[model samples]
Target: MATYDPFRDLERLASSFLETGRRGPREMPMDLYRAGDHYVLSTDLPGIDPGSVDIDVDGQLLTIRAERTLTTDDSAQWITRERTGGTFLRQLSLGQGLDTERITASYNNGVLNVTIPVSEKAKPRKIEITTQDGQQQIESTTA
Candidate 1:
C-alpha cells in the first residue's frame, strides 16, 4: 500500500507551474577564458548528438546551437522524467582584435571547445626608437 504524501503532490504542482510555457530554446552552461594569444570557450552538452551541433559567426557575433532528443518506449513504465530534451542555444558578442576567420571548434566527450586566435595587429609587439644621433634603440610595447 502507498501512503499519502501532500508534500510530494505540492512539489509536483510547483514544478509543473514553473515549467509551463517554457517551449523556447534552453540555455547551455559555458566557460570562456584567455590562454596566451588565444581564447578558449568550453560548453557542456551531454547526451547531445555531435552532428546536431551548429556554430556560426556573423561579424562580431558568435552563435552556438544544438539539439537533444530523448527516446520513449510505449510499453515501458516511467517512474520519473526529469531530464528534458530540446534545443539548446548560446550566443556571445566577440570583442575586437580577434581573428574570427581563423576560429575553430571541436566536440569531444560531450563538451564543445572553441578556439579564437588573436589577430596579428592586436598582439604585443616591439617598437624601434631612433635617437638624435641616428642611433636605433629597441623598446617593448603593446599594440
Candidate 2:
C-alpha cells in the first residue's frame, strides 16, 4: 500500500498556486563590464529561442526581450512542471560616451552578448603639452 502525506500535498498545492500567479514576464539575469574601448553585456537565456530574441536602443535606454515556449501534450501526464514559459525582459540606461549606433549583439549557447563601443570623443589619447621653453611633452589624458 502507498502512504498518503497531507503535508506534501498541501505544499504542492501552494507551489502550484504561486506558479500560476506568476504569469507576467520574467527578468533576464545579466553581467556587464568594460573591456578596453567597449562594454560587454551578457545575459543568460537558457531554453529561449534565438529567433525570439530582440534587442533595441531608444535614446539612452537599451532593452532586451526574449520568449520561451513549452510544448504540452494533452495525453501525457506531468510529474513536475517547474520550467516556466513566458517572456524575458531586461532594460538598461546607457551612460553618455557610448557609441549606440555601432552597438551589436549575438546569441550563442543560450547566452546573448552585446557590445557597445566607446565614442571617439570619449576615448583616451596623448596630448602634446608645450612648455615655455619651446619643448613639447606628451601627456596621456582621457577625454
Candidate 3:
C-alpha cells in the first residue's frame, strides 16, 4: 500500500490554481509562454495605468501590485454596484531556469508584457561527436 502526501500535493495544486485562475476577479491575468530562449508573460490590466503598477522580484518569486482609484460626481448615484475596484496583489514563483536580473517588462495597450531571459545554464545545448582515430568527442557546449 502507498500513502499520499496531501500537504505537498495541496500546496502544488493551490499554486497551479493561483497561476491559472479566472480573469477580472483575478488581478492582472497573465498568459505565459516559452519563446525560443526566453519566457514571456503577458498580462491584461484594463483601466490600470503602468505607473500605478509595481513589480517586484525576490529570489524566484515575482509580485505585481497595483492600486486602482475610482471616482464619481456628487450627482451620480450608484443604483447597482458589482465592479469593486481596489488594490490587488499577485505573485508567482518563477522557475530556476530564468535569469531574474535580465528580466524585461513593458506595458502597452492595456497589457503588460514581461520577458524573462533564460539563464545560459538553463538553455539546451547540442553536442557533436567527432572521430579522432576511432574516438568520439564533444563538439560544443551551450546553455
What local distance difference test score does each model get?
Answer: 0.92, 0.92, 0.78
Model 1: what TM-score? 0.85
Q: All candidates' TM-scores?
A: 0.85, 0.83, 0.69
Question: What local lDDT score does residue 30 receive in model 3, on the 0 to 100 scale?
Answer: 72
lDDT of 1 by residue, 1-143 (tens): 99999999999878866664468899999999999999999999999999999999999999999999989899989776777788999999999999999999999999999999999999998887888997887665766
RMSD of 3: 12.2
Query: Candidate 2 or 3, higher lDDT?
Result: 2
Q: Of the pair 1 and 2, which is ahead by TM-score?
A: 1
| RMSD to truth, every model | 3.1, 3.4, 12.2
Question: In model 3, what is the error at residue 47, expressed in angstroms?
Answer: 0.6
Candidate 2: clashing pairs of residues: none
Over 4 Å off in model 1, which ranges?
Answer: 1-9, 132-134
Q: Who is ahead in TM-score, 2 or 3?
A: 2
Provide the lowest-lDDT 10-residue window in model 2: 134-143
Model 2 C-alpha lDDT per residue in residues 31-111, reported as the tens digit of each score: 999999999999999999999999999999999999999999999998888888888899999999999999999999999
Clashing pairs in 3: none
**Per-residue lDDT for 21 in model 1?**
46
